[model samples]
Target: MNVLDLLEQWKQSDTFNNTLSDDHQVISYQEAYLRISVYSDWLASNSFTQPMAFYCAQSIEHLLMLIALMFNEVNFVLLPVKSTDVDKELFADQLTLKPHFCDMLRHIQLTKQAQCKTVATPGRIYFKTSGSLGTPKLVVHQRHNLIANSRNVLTRLPLNASSRVLIPVPMHHMYGFGAALWPCLLVGASIHLTSNLNILRFKAVERQFAPTVAYLTPSTVGALLLRSCKSSQYEFIVSAGDCFDRQTFQQAQTKFGRVFNLYGSTELGVVAIGEIQSKGEAVDDCVTALPGVKIKIESEQIAVKHPFGFDFYLYQQTRDVFFNTGDLARGDEITGFSVIGRAKLSINREGRLIAFSELESQIKQHQHIQDVALVKGRKDSKGHTIVAIVESTTELAPDELRRQLGKFLPRYATPSKIIIEPQLPRLVSGKINRKQIALHYEETEF
Candidate 1:
């Protein structure tokens, strides 16, 4: 069913409660239903259609715009709030979708002239990657696929009329859509939206909303643990979009009590989830697969089969139904599985292939290294440098670290330069901001 039908049903039911606060405003089932209906009506009066581009920041307006589009069975391209002019132009040219800039506080009448013609009707939502790994690709997901995937996630953490879901990530990203927003909407749970990552704001939101659960990234969870907060503030925390380090996991457990790690990507939603007891232990086997979704490993690459998995881009030439996620994974009969690392990040230096994740794991083993990212840099006089951008707690000479890596890695694989920074810049999802790091190194003398 379309999102509007669900909303209409919930609005008439007694389960609707429209209580939300400025600090901790949560959309009750009823309020969410009413708001979505109002927005849908407004969009219908205006000329809104499927396959449009939504360009806006993370706010109530953003959420409402998405809901309106979904209600109308419109497929939208989510333009990141920080998108550059180049990004917008390229997206428009490629997708052939017209842009919709949201103005929430004001009601502006939209006309049919504003609507963009649909280029392709894959009957799915499209999301763009960060383009850090390479050029950004549009990932297509069916509405039913999302609903099915969300049902699987709900099996792990059931939602109901009494449940409140705190959304820390932007709705555009798959993590935000699958984990926080869609799941709540599916089960009549309250949704509390917060764009700020400030610890005080998080604490205040939790205290005021009393949300039963929340979705967070590793970096956000770490930051929350570092701050002063009561353990009883949250029942459970779900981490996704990036790996959760051991220290951060422990710190969160100490602060918030329960933490769960989610694994998936834009191509595949909610592949697996496990309770993180400590970072050192293997990720638990407990995982719930969405209905009609199947997982398998073909030559170490995580491959997925589902009715909804579509092309990397709407304009792309290739059309492979099964997605081959470039991730190494392992599974046992009893424990299920866990993703080891990305296949693209694996490097070949001096005739030896070394996984970037392995290199990162080794570097993070250092007591002073809080976080590190290893990327292949331009070939220098001493072969390809495994450049390491490190977030360090204490001073560590680059020469010394290079010497340490040489013992395990080949001489050629040893990092030629170790750029120490106070903190690693991260994407909104809290993954290492590789694009920013590349820019940083470009400006540096080394």
Candidate 2:
């Protein structure tokens, strides 16, 4: 259903009383709709045809403006909720956006105007892909794509009017918007959106409104698990990002009842939902595909096609019927499928191509290592070399890490350089900033 229809249906039913709480205040569905309408009316009057990018204010108003724009011209790009100048210049050649959107306060101030009502203008929503292997690209989708994808999630997950979801991820990212916001809004479920995620802040939220489902990243999950909160109201723990190793997954399932590692891309909303297995069931990283979604391995890359999947990538100049998610995956009848790594992250060393993420996963198996990131260093005469940056819970030596990885991976996949650090850098969406890490080690020698 369309957003307006969804909101109207909720208003007509008992769901209108359901709450949408942020860090500061709590408001009911009807209350939020009134606020959103005020912003949307302003957008509908200002005419625009070209796609425009946005900077996040990280408030209830940002969401209101997005909902408002969706009701109007529909074509707007969300630059990954990060405060960067690149987002400002993305549509520079195409659209003229007056009054740059900086990080203001809770509400967005749009100069209001009145124009004659027009037909509902529908357009695409472009989200920035995680720039793990290379430069980030935009994934173009529509409101229907988001609605269909959220419906798929709602169909799979046990969510209803009574469900309360915790949304810690940024609203600008597809994971937070498509996975958290749309599903919660469409299903008439309440959401507890936190401005900050920490021991004191989250504990406060838990005391006020007990969250049923937590859609968080592995990093956030790790931090949350360490907290001494006396609450156990979490029924489902949803996580994405490559950092979800077997150890993290099992620990989450132990604490929270059911933990599902959502395997998805911004291009294809959510392809599979792998129930993070317990201690040992011969963990195979098997993720079951959603209905009506087709998956295949072309040139060893995971290719997907679904109704919810977007067709073109405007920035990359890629137009395809099947979105070839440069991710490397393996599937069979028994094991289903497993997403291993990205095709762009593969390092060709001595004619053997090794996925950096796959190699990093193998290294993370070493008990002492807390986190790992693999980056491609400068190419010497032998070829491109791999660098492993380790974040260990306990003390770890580089030589010992290599000795451990030698048992799990081949020599070609082994990191030529190991940099020890207290923590690994991450993007807003919880994906490793492999782009940044790669640039860091690129200037150094092995």
Candidate 3:
């Protein structure tokens, strides 16, 4: 069913009696509907026609704005207000500018705005990858994709009526919106939306709500472990979108009980799910694919054709039959698949190819390494040197980290530059803005 159909179903179900809550307030679905109705009335009164962009700042308002837009059939973009290295011009000429948010919409002078395409049908949600890396283009999904993507998570995961989900991730991200938020909405389960994701706020969420499910990333889990969180019980924690360190997974499993690894991307919904019990996973490192999702290891890269595949492009307006996830992997449909690394991120050091993710993952295994990001360094007559930007507590010398790296990686796989930093800049989705980091070093150090 489409978003409108789902909304209508919820209106008729007991879900209307349930509540949607955040850090600050709690409102029933009925109340949310009324507020959305008022906002819808406001939009209609103002003749809102352009494809809007909402600076989704973790609140009930952000959630309601999405719902209201979906109902109003307004094409929109959700930009995280706090993401690092975000292109300020990512939405230029593509959206009705700010000052249109909240109360300012009525006051802003009308300008030539980009008009949204008049589609005869519903379920056209627009999403763009974190634009730090390249020219950000909108990845579009239709109604069936929305439902199928949500169901892929809902079916595999064990959320129930009693479950209370703690969402520290932003709703703009597919990991957060599709996998985390959609299931809660579909199941009529309780959700506590946090204004920000941090150790203090995370503890506060647990202390206040006693939530059963948590949507987290590798970096957030690392932050929690670094803060020495108490061993807690959770139904399951889904980790996605980045290279989750094996050690961090063990620590998270110890702290949160069961940690489930969900593999997917913004272009495609979740491809697989696996439970981690210890430091070492299965030899194949298998993760079962969702029903109707066909996965193939074409030339060692994971390619998937699923119902949730982004059907249309907001700008290009074309459809891709299959999404070739640039990730490298090995497995059959029966054996499932394991992500090796991203094809584009592979570096050639002295003509010996080294997958950057493998190098970064190896470095992250260091006891002192809290977080690590890999970027290509200077190129001369020699070869392209791999750089490792590391986040650690104690002072680190390049030589020492190199020595540590020698223990795990081969000579060629060892990073050429070891820059110690207090922290690496990351997108709101928790993946390191590698393109930004590479560009920064290219300008300064190279």
How do the residues 1-446 of candidate 3 rate in per-residue lDDT, one tens digit apiece? 53456668676656777777887678887777776776677656765444455556666766776666666766556667554443433332232223223454442233434443433233466676743223455677764576568877877888766677888777887777888887787777778887557788787778877877888876677776666655555777887644455667767766777777788777786778776544346322357788788887878977788877787655576655777777787676676666766677765443244667656766888988988988777754234677788888757687787787887776767777788888888899998888789887752445
Write down the RMSD of all candidates, one decimal each. 11.4, 11.7, 11.2
lDDT of 1 at 131: 46
Clashing pairs in 2: none
- The TM-score measured for candidate 1 stands at 0.69
Error of 1 at 302 (Å): 1.2
My TM-score estimates for the predictions, one after another, are 0.69, 0.70, 0.69
Which regions of candidate 3 deviate over 4 angstroms?
1-13, 82-123, 226-233, 279-285, 317-320, 346-446
Number of clashing pairs per prediction, in order: 3, 0, 0
* Residue range 209-240, candidate 1, lDDT tens digits: 77777888765676666556466656777876
Q: What C-alpha lDDT does candidate 1 achieve relative to the native structure?
A: 0.63
* 1 versus 2: better TM-score goes to: 2
lDDT of 2 by residue, 404-434 (tens): 7777666767787778888888899988787
Model 3: what TM-score? Answer: 0.69
In candidate 2 the C-alpha lDDT for residue 219 amounts to 61
